[model samples]
Target: MEAAFRYREREGDLKAPYEHTEGPYPLGRWLSEQRRTFRAGQMDGERAAELEGLGIVWDTADAAFETNLAAARAYYRLHGTLAAPRGAAILDVQVGQWLTNVRRPGGLGQDPVRAERRAAALAAVDPDWNPAVLGWTVDWQRHYAYLAQLLDEGARLRAVTAGVTRHGEDIGRWLVTQRRDWARLNPEQQARLTALGVTPARVVRARQAPAKKRSTTTSGRGAAAFEAGVQALAQYLAREGGGTPGRSHVERLPDGSEHRTGVWLANQRQRRDRLDTGQLEALAGLGVPWAAS
Candidate 1:
């Protein structure tokens, strides 16, 4: 036990090599025996619990998945997406290569249930973990995620200047191209941009008229926010099957950005009186329980 403790302390986990030793003790062999005992139902309950506390991973496959998952989560937290280039790495983990392989069919494993579970775990980390699975390119999703972040931070769409960039993507250029070629975008892309207060170039030019300038901002802001909320709710429904998200639930969008859908839902319920008929109808269409009020 002392050898096990010392090994765990130094190695961060109990998976020592079979030939490993802690001084004179055959700690690796001893740990292997413990696993055998546990599997045979001969190990004491308290002893099993103690080993678990020491991070004794019973299954090597699950352990590998968990280790890689930690690296994926860290990368997502930093870049907001798992769309890593093939050469990308987080510390010692080749997260980019791992993600690339996992995105392929049967790359997780041959076992259906385990593969589904692993895929679900990755999805929980980044809903659009595989951009191809959602009918979009990784680069497109990355750009959209940056735009979503900017909007959520209260940066108006028009204020995204020509030199603006995020993660080396010229978002300002992307925005201009998106607006100029709004018709070139698929319905989903157009809907997402519209939710963020973006419009066609022609409409934008028309709204630049002084007579409509003030009203445009005020009206666009509320409508865009509401549309974003609705889009988030719809996405939640698609991902979770049903039931509302809790207040702390942060929804990862297809573009790799997160939306505080729970908070938005709560705010909507509290301020239901301020919503227009069309907005209310939109929420009701999504089967929001409180929207009927």
Candidate 2:
């Protein structure tokens, strides 16, 4: 066994070293020093020799050093910061390009609001694109679409406000309050608008459904009972007042006081420990009354 182990160890020692798959190992902190030297138009003979010893090759010794030094200087000037220590600088270059594309007049434009919105969208899509810098990239087409959408919305809002004679509620505020009414319109309502060749402004108003009247008896009773149950549960949890054990904590006495008592008791039990699925199923099977409101 010892003789076999010795032979295996010798075989392992003779194996070739692992080859680095990618070219141009990152210069990292050495980049700043390299840039300074390049700006001064000088090359370090010792550093060039070290890189060559690590299996990096150049057509000629002086050419290799000059090429490396020039590249380092160019990168630092563009980024205004160091490239990530370990990876290719390709991503950094792409981010720089994306920044430049957004700043052009026809790009995001000089409008502060639109520019800010575009910058935010670009940053969200690609965080490496510092919006403050100038650069260009193909990925900026995505940000262009987003900025276009914002401009469209702004135009629509302006048109809506311009058409409205009343200024009490602005277009944006009215849209927020009426969102649910706008969502609930039927297919027939939508079809009628389409048949008339209706404008977008008319379509916005057409989508709103008529408000329904509230049920005073059922809804009011259910709401009052639920509120009483909540108050009773809070009092029980806090262990407050010298009140009767089964009495609800509501200020107003309910019309059907017995029903409120049942709700309050159930709430108290729920507060102690929540009901399990099996327990809930058992209670449901027993035809226990549940509030509709």
Candidate 3:
């Protein structure tokens, strides 16, 4: 036991796999701890390389914005209300403020809708990359509230029309006709109805706003585009007046906001292999490689 304690002093017990909760989150915790050590000037060159090889940063950062939204959504479900960012709670104020600041206009801020869609697209591309999901869950209470009001109106109308032989077919037909109305709805109204499970089906699905500039990563072309983007950037950077890409970049979010990140970050190799989808496309647009040899 004494020897074990001494050995633990020299090397921590974190090398083993964690029990119970096992996924990217635990791994992300380890990665973050190692990063803290590196930041505090504790990691040597080889150790740093090993940590880099784990590819934790690339995955975490790529998923970070959306994952935070997912966790927040999960919080709302368990807690029975939207916390700080979305809700008007005092307890969740600091937390909510932090969330707002984190996903502010400059860089990757919290956007659950876009995150979910991108995650869905990623899952469509490769199911293995599926992260913790918080989906478009329904609020039956709101649906009931709306339905109750409508039903009351129906009752009043029926009482007035009792002299005539009338059926509720008109109401039923109107309700189902909402399917046609769904497509005509603006995005927010459709979203509200969707949340209430009252949205109707339509032949035409709303189209996503196109990216102002073409992004190869979002495009369906697979490895070929990635390799070509890498080659393109390499060629562009090698030409003249090109700098290794700033970690900060201009990104267009789903809300039609063009956000430019304020902070510059390290160029982790794993990022190229993982998070490089959007970044590479941005670089390709600017006609330069992110990192040139």
Candidate 4:
């Protein structure tokens, strides 16, 4: 297990909290002593910090991350497949592995967003092929789809179940994410799936559904007022805070009217969480920066 995996440093400097802990905060200048401290993404921050600031000097963060990956890699090695059992609730396991960026020394790491892709690829392959490489087009995280090298079209599969799985919301649902993918299915197949409330159109709508409605605080507003409120929030973000307001951060002006920008900025500073890509893009469209804290 140790031979197949080793810790690799993703970066040189450590980030905040663990960035410069002098055995404590503020006077953490002693962090430089561990020059090779492995950079751990925000997976298990407290443990990562302890590993770096306490014992395990060199490659501390990477060691912690790699050690965890060893277990998952063992499963993959034994199965020659990364697929979990039919009822193992596979996505949950994938989420845990991805949180720490687990990977082989030079191999691609797990990504939560791409769980579906990996799952689909695994579904595309035949159970007979184990540990086969160089098949699918899943880029680096190729956990499945490795097949025989023979050049025979007779062994090919016709539109196997790549996206659809017997899972929640997706249970009996087609894997066709976009409406166009429906072309792969014949009219009989389409009708059979639709009868079970699992059609390509339904899948697209489910995936594109908007988030749950806002809290009761804003539930009274009509559609027109909702648009106005969003526009006002955007303009305020552009003018005052320079960033978008989050659920926690928000404030009221001197006149007593709640100002979304002011409060969002305040809360953002109080809780130093990073904004995701989608959030940053939305703020960019409004001429506001993505600065959270």
Best candidate, lDDT: 1
lDDT of 4 by residue, 1-293 (tens): 11111111322334322222232243222332333343434336565565544334454444333333333444445434443232221212442234222121112324543443333333343232111122111111122112111112233322324542221223112233313345443454456445433446534344566655432322344433333434455444322323345655444433455545545544434432343333433433444443412
Evaluation by lDDT, superior candidate among 1 and 2: 1
Q: Which ten residues in a row have the lowest lDDT in candidate 1?
A: 209-218
Write one digit per residue (lDDT tens) for candidate 1, span 158-203: 7897788877768899889788767556688889889988888885
Q: Compare the candidates by TM-score and give the number of the best one.
A: 1
Which residue pairs collide in model 4, if any? 22-28, 249-263, 249-264, 250-263, 250-264, 251-263
Looking at model 2, the pairs that clash are 97-135, 97-136, 97-137, 100-135
- Candidate 4 C-alpha error for residue 5, in Å: 18
Clashes of each: 0, 4, 3, 6
lDDT of each: 0.75, 0.35, 0.39, 0.34
Higher-scoring candidate on lDDT, 1 or 3: 1
Give lDDT for model 3.
0.39
Per-candidate TM-scores read 0.50, 0.18, 0.29, 0.22
| Lowest lDDT 10-residue stretch of candidate 2 | 13-22
For 160-255, candidate 2 gives per-residue lDDT tens digits of 332232212233333332232332323443343334332233343465577554323224565554455544332332121112344443322224
